[model samples]
Target: MTFTAARVIGALMMAGLGWFVSDLVRPLMPESTIFGWFNHVNLGLGFLIGWAMLGPKAGGGLMISLANGLTAAFALATVGLFTQAINEMLRLSTRKMYPNPLRALEDIFRILADYGSVLLHPTVIGPLIIGSVVIAIIVEIANSLWR
Candidate 1:
């Protein structure tokens, strides 16, 4: 789906804000911070922007997730981004009863996180979580607005 200028503008604005927040707070956070809250926030924002402007039916959220993941240094971010896309696709496929599918998908991510310490860069893991949340929130909001 073609992203309208509004979507791109909103997504970029949110992503920038997310990065700024993450950069500011990451230094004070513990090494073991659970889920990159900031990153997720940013990602959610991005998703919202894309989904709202491009239309949820256009698969914009999934595309945004992938783009954010690719930009990160952590393997966790990469995995989460791709997994989120898969999850989005699944939800898209089964339009009705998405609550269950969403839960299952998240559970899978948490399970994958168990093995993350071994492969993902320590620095990138937190941001990845943050990224996912950020994207999800944004996309959902935008999608709702559109609808």
Candidate 2:
């Protein structure tokens, strides 16, 4: 809510990261129908986490800010993963893929595990690690320059 320059920069940077990461993972997705709103969801989540989490820690200190940036990036990924898994679970339930509600609930975790394994690929993690560092440095620079 402070709406500082660092916040704006952080939000936009993370949003870009979101879009890029989504694109990277797109081909790995099992179903095409679920991708319609995927990018948008990631964008919003990234922006929110950046603005609220990373932005506030920008001026705190170099090490602290860097740690926070990495944490925020992981948070974004975790939330996005959960969001997509739940969406997929709901879709599957609607299709009656599970014989019972309990089985449907179990499938959510199964889907999460499956996607979690995919996320472990170097292709997905490498950029995220690199981007977090870059984003942290950029936001810290914006904070110092503006304030």
Candidate 3:
């Protein structure tokens, strides 16, 4: 497939995968799991799914980042889009600061986006993170099993 086709397909696939995982998770925990440390799974896996499927040869990172941002749009027309935008922006900016300041900022944004829920809700910021990861891992295991 061409670069454009691959990118679109990847983004769509990841969006479906993300939605599926998030929906599966919606019932497992209370509505409070918003801290977001583990929320990166959506962003990470979504990006990887897109990169692996639709990304072009050279400018792969940019395509993945853009696809990730688009996934946010597909996710829903809500506050999360803004957060995802910021996350993608921070991630792009910090590409050079791996393992340092850049990464730290990216992590903070990811956490905030996941749990920026309410002003003072005692959020399970941790559960969402942990739960999401566990669930994503299960999905991955299932994918492997099927493959």
Least accurate stretch of 10 residues (summed lDDT) in model 2?
27-36
Query: lDDT by residue for model 2 over 1-147, one digit each (tens)?
Result: 678988999899998998888888877767655687989999998888889888888888788877887797789879988998998899898888989999988888998998888777789877876787789889998999997
Models 1 onward score TM values of: 0.29, 0.92, 0.29
Clash totals in order? 18, 0, 4
- lDDT tens per residue, model 3, 1-147: 444544544445544545544444445445654435334555455555444533332233443444434433333323444555466556556565456676666666564554345312233333333333333333333333433
Q: What RMSD does each model have against the real structure? A: 14.3, 1.5, 13.3
Q: What is candidate 1's lDDT per residue for 1-147, written digit by digit as tens?
A: 556443554466445644554554455545775443546754565555433532333234656644543343233344344554455445444665446656756655564454344324545455544654454445445555664
What's the lDDT of the predicted structure labeled candidate 3?
A: 0.44
Q: Between candidates 1 and 2, which one is better according to lDDT?
A: 2
Best by lDDT: 2
Which pairs clash in model 2?
A: none
Q: Who is ahead in TM-score, 2 or 3?
A: 2
